[model samples]
Target chain A: MAEVVTNLSRKEQVIRMAAELFKEKGYSAASMRDLAQKLGIEAASLYSHIKSKEEILRTLCFDMAAEFRTSLSEVEKQNVSASEKLRLGIIGHVKVMAKDLTASAVFMNEHRHLSQPWLRDFLLLRINYINRFKTIIEQGVSTGDFKKDIDTKLAVMTLFSSLNWMPGWFNPDSTIEPEKLGQQLADMLINGLKQNA
Target chain B: MAEVVTNLSRKEQVIRMAAELFKEKGYSAASMRDLAQKLGIEAASLYSHIKSKEEILRTLCFDMAAEFRTSLSEVEKQNVSASEKLRLGIIGHVKVMAKDLTASAVFMNEHRHLSQPWLRDFLLLRINYINRFKTIIEQGVSTGDFKKDIDTKLAVMTLFSSLNWMPGWFNPDSTIEPEKLGQQLADMLINGLKQNA
Candidate 1:
């Protein structure tokens, strides 16, 4: 676990610890003092790196959104078939979630606690991210890669729900690796979406 | 919407209003007073029908769990192919969620706030429900109707995730109906799981 945090700056470390605290105690219940105590620092020192708990939540949410965009853009750039793009896209999504389990989990579950402009901004980023996935599926549909009658929005939501729900049930200790799980799920979804058996 | 609440007793009406409040404001941020304000009643009167905000949440969680169990049990009793059973099961699950959107959403998101014994009990029911779905898929594999190599747990997680994630996005006014969504999703999943797909 120490290796996971190694080479990170102090601010990065604080955000990481705050993510874990938020995941454990939830965003509303987790206090700045608790986050500081977890890092073996005073509450005053904690504020130097991060302004508030919601700031940590906002960072996690935006960072996860950025990670998804990075993952999708890489897949989008490949000249492979749309089917291949989707499989690769799912694998990339899972990799990001695996890379930072706590931050991603907190991002998934606790972003609802963010208030006002930040919440609006985070949600806009999220919508843009979802639209990116929809774009892939829409391309697939237009290319006759997926079912002709496919509802792109429904398919995208379904695909994402399978991947996004990972944070809730994913076992970091599980023997099944993220890429393998992602590959299998991608295959399953593609089989469903394919124009023909 | 008034007609929706017309048949219920006063206590049942309180729980329904609370579910909407919880869905809108979230469980922690929502208060008994807000619920009363929504219903145009005294906060003290709100207590007469439901003892606490958590009480309404507990009722919703347990009741939704029961609905799922009932849905699954009905599907389980069907004298049909495992594939058909799975399809019916999903349709039933969707109907339950669609029937009471707000309560189902609260059940999905806010059950994390439940206290020890109730939380433990709710989780147990949930695990049992999930396993029941697994059993259906396992039966499909045993019957040679599904991919023998299927990771039943992964397949189940993927399937449930698609349906469970619905509360966050489902539009009651959508032209596409719940049963239709369930059927299409079930078809996609089955295609993914079919041995020869």
Candidate 2:
């Protein structure tokens, strides 16, 4: 599990361990028994904490999505220039990824295993989140903060892809603060979108 | 499969379907028998072309890695400004991804299933590939074609993260040609890195 890096949580041991297991074995292949064995808890005790594997995955996906939504809304509320708003947005997203590296990786990679109504809701949550970004870019362009000619959809995707790949590489104990890392990342992407003086 | 998106191949039917199945079921969970059933062929017939499931994955990862290496070497041979070279390099990569969407998706997602030696070799190939992009950005910086103050490592990673997420969202029947799409992506990224004229 990524160089024996599984002990990523203390109080939330079950959720983190299941995230690691789900990440390792894929959601469908991993059993409650396996998770229980890893946690040294009985399957019945595990059942008390969580209903099913899918429920855990659902919680991670929606909770992370909600965090992102909340972060974006917080950034949007600031009375900053459109460019600064975008920079802060990038930082906010990176902070979310840095806060829970394993869970973020699980959300990014294993969320596909989520079932019907949950999957639909997850997709809706995701699209609405992305749409808010588009609005930010649109406002940035209109205010001359960004290049008027930039493709809003591609730019937003580029911003996300740049920001979302963080968990694949970020170290859990790296000295670089998440906010500073976010600042550098924001500098890179926002500079690309920024209009010339 | 991704919303009934599995019919993504023709001549290389076995490999493509395997990629899809591997993507859906994860390489560990998917079996030779399942692959044979999906292919409408006998198990022996499946073995005649591919020795094992891991062997199929090895071919995908190494072959795609080789393609990327070849593309980088080809771009390096061209005598152009570093920024233009970078743009062409990006186009080369996007064309590779766009050429075989399903296989590329599988390569990105399922390469982790590769065993030890293959995994080590894959990592080396990837780092070397990434290093080439870093050198290009470095040269772009040295030539005063890019911002002198940029973090080269972060900038290269940003370029890759921006490019590597294509399979997640790019439509198989996208109206945008890979080259043109590559052009826009290159413009967005390079402008971010470009020195003020």
Candidate 3:
């Protein structure tokens, strides 16, 4: 069986290889030398494409934050009811994790280690993404599509936590497909098994 | 408010303080001198209580693994049905995260950095605790108590990914109490809101 050729850019290829190293071995444990070796280039050659390991992390975090924001935007554009929007929101969150697990992991785990001004900006983006979800949930509750008792804010946090951590466990090589995983997660979030009247 | 007195041993005290440093700053970034400085002791004097920073990490990992295992054992001892056992199992998992968030963080995040022997022991204990939940889930499904359509192993893993990650989001100061959080998560996992049967 022939392997599928993945057409990655020089920059994109570095990000992919760095993400694997960072995830398998935590950021500090994985070094520039190791990453350079994985890329089949000299350590000095890596600098031509990337400034530092920190930049690689920031790239991953920023790109994921962008993609996540984009997914939410797409969900917002759909002319659907609040409940369907919420379902789509869940789908969007899981799909991001599924499609870009490494970037998602870097965004979720390593962004906390970023320094001051950059960290603040990264956090602002993350909080905005979170609020986007919270607003959708709030709309669902107000529109009578979800239970009145639902704490829209806390529910969003719990839902995001559940969805964000999926990359740590999900294996793309496994039999479970991403869309199916999204649907199962969305079902659990929206209409948990208790029969709705 | 009166200051709460700590009843931890000198060694335990050292480990506790070190864990906070390790958690806030990644393990590689935290130093023995920094740990000793935090404890109000000379760096050389600290070796009397511990061999090195790695030793502190090993002790913390063992403490966390033990706490988790003990909680699972209590769940196992409960004279309840397999489904109820599963609920308690999840509750137990979340409780550990809430109560021992730092140690749990170190165990979950840093154990891979351990030397081979310690890593082997940590993995063994980790698997043992995981198997407890898997067995409970398997029993529940086989008894027709849980939705048999759900893969027991994946469901157990997903449940764990959800619970184990609570520390990243949970705040003790938050209005949501652990008990209520546990109950809500339990409901979401077990019953999922699929219109109440």
Best by DockQ: 1
Question: Candidate 1's residue-wise lDDT over B60-163, tens digit each?
Answer: 99999999899899889889988889999998999999998888889888888899999999999999999999999999999999988888998999999999
lDDT of 2 by residue, B1-197 (tens): 76335433332577777888886766767788888899898767886666787888887778788888898899999999999999999999999988877778778888887889889989988999999889988999999999999889889888888888987888878688999999999988888788782
Which CAPRI level is candidate 2? medium
Chain B TM-scores across candidates:
0.92, 0.89, 0.87
Q: lDDT (CA) for every model shown? A: 0.86, 0.83, 0.78
**Chain A TM-scores of all predicted models:** 0.89, 0.88, 0.89
User: How many clashes does each candidate structure show, in the order listed?
Assistant: 0, 0, 17
| Superior by TM-score: candidate 2 or candidate 3 | 2
lDDT tens digits, residue span A121-188, model 1: 88898888888788878888899988888878888888888888888888999988889988888988
In TM-score terms, candidate 3 sits at 0.88
Deviation in angstroms for B165 in model 2?
0.4
What are the runs in model 2 whose C-alpha is more than 4 Å off? A1-11, A28-34, A41-45, B1-11, B29-34, B42-45
Q: Who is ahead in TM-score, 1 or 3? A: 1
DockQ scores of all models, one per candidate: 0.62, 0.52, 0.45
